[model samples]
Target: MSDDLKVTAELRESFGKGAARKLRALGKIPAVLYGHGTEPVHVSLPGHQMLLILRKSNAVLELDIDGKGQLALVKDVQKDPVRQIIEHIDLIVVRKGEKVTIDVPIHLEGEAAPGTTVNQDSNTISLEALATAIPESVVVSIEGAEDGTQIFAKDLILPEGSSLITDEDTLIVAISIAQEQDLGEETDEAPAEEAAPAAE
Candidate 1:
């Protein structure tokens, strides 16, 4: 299941650090909405509400501003390192039903074959999906994969309403034999050379 997020925003007229700090004290998050060739709009959103909606990565927000509705995609989130609070957020205006390219996390699942290891070449891949229906992430399986086996972007199963924008040849992940396992092989034959005599 997916998360449904809606945020209410008020048109903001003030700008700069002073106004922003003041807004923060009142638990409002200063934000800007831009993109789709429209002029930027400054607004203040409820901080608590925005935080709840932002917990999910790549969240799509339905912004209700003065009874006006618009589709918004999270572009950037500024945080205060010390407080771990969201200082500001940038939302890109998007149209419903339009495909926008974004990176979705790649989830590694299942264990590889015994004595083998898995190495992820890419953490995420860009995909063109419906603005209002963007997926949370892409999942790939490595169940019982042996050494030298590789998973490519094209091999991923995209969620409904999502399409791959990355190159089909791009390496997504790979599995290989563990070094210790390879070194564990022993020889039956004993060494021909004699060891040096123990010190007297």
Candidate 2:
């Protein structure tokens, strides 16, 4: 949960849609940082650098503003539907050893029994982990698993200090036999030729 990402942000005085658009034109992302009963601070972050840091799941950020370091987590991100560019971002300030609940992706390992298909009911599980050490993903093994086998959330072996926040009975993965698709028979019907007598 180390804040591997460090970036500098500038205070943004302007507000509203027009201002946000102008910032995007300059390759800056408008963002708000607020948490722990603190006032929301508006700022502009470097678009390219933020994009690269966000490639990882649950990215933790160490923001250096005016020589003051603040630890934060990405809470929400708004993006343009068509352009797929960052529109606005919302961040929550956090501190060391703080427990936060976040969704961690499930990684499937190995193959299930032959002729059987692995049906994953849930791809991510909710975990209560330290803000600085949140897991990137959890791996579940289905190797040699037989049909009708189901894995539940409670059965997951969590990382060192993380705990499952999702319901224990939640179905994570289900191994079942694959159903074969059958195509309907094709018709051989063809259009009849017009009679030449009509021309007479």
Candidate 3:
């Protein structure tokens, strides 16, 4: 993890919806941290800074909780449905070199063979990797792949230390022939009298 991901948080003493709304109004986000059989600690984080850091997936935060240092992983986020506002966040404690299981997004590197339609069945894959060294995403290349070609989860090439946690048989991508759309030219050529008789 980079030092840019580090954040200084304040231990929150208040709880409940009203307190949370007040915190948000003050440009702070309400959050809870827990793991390793420890009691959950409620904290308030800088909203703008956290928003920027969370743009990347699986963000690991090196936190300063009232002068005490702790490492935590972004576990889950709750947002407002209409406004997309960050309502709350859940953090799980982690240590350096600890292996954590998380889903990594899949990125396609190249285009398939011309005229072939590419169908992506899975958008992300599960991986078990060191918490501090988690990869941002897994790349799968389809350059020059022909129609009827299929790529499965087992075929993915992962980062050096990461291991696949998803089932091996899961389909990732499938390439097939693209179907042409009908232009309705045939319907225009039919006689009006014949079409009326068929409708009756």
**Number of backbone-clashing residue pairs for each candidate, in the order shown:** 0, 2, 0
Return the lDDT, model 2, position 181: 37
Better of 1 and 2 by TM-score: 2
- Supply the global lDDT for candidate 3: 0.94
State model 2's lDDT: 0.89
By lDDT, the candidates rank as: 3, 2, 1
Candidate 2 lowest-lDDT run of ten: 183-192
For model 2, name the residue pairs that clash.
1-132, 1-133
Candidate 3 lDDT over 1-200, as tens digits, reads 58779899999999999999999999999999999999999999999999999999998899999899999999999999999999999999999989999999999999999999999999999999999888999999999999999999999999989999999999999998886543355466567757898899
- Put down candidate 1 lDDT per residue, 112-132, tens digits, no spaces: 999888999999999999887
Candidate 3 displacement at residue 70 in angstroms: 1.0
lDDT per residue for candidate 2 within 72-187, as digits (tens), equals 89999998899888899999999998988899999999999999989999999999999989888999999999999999999988998899899999999999887653221222
C-alpha root-mean-square deviation, each candidate: 4.4, 6.2, 2.7
Off by over 4 Å in 3: 181-200
TM-score of 2: 0.87
**Which of the two, 1 or 2, has more lDDT?**
2
TM values, all candidates: 0.86, 0.87, 0.91
Q: Rank the candidates by TM-score, best first.
A: 3, 2, 1
lDDT of each: 0.87, 0.89, 0.94
Deviation in Å, model 3, residue 160 alpha carbon: 1.2
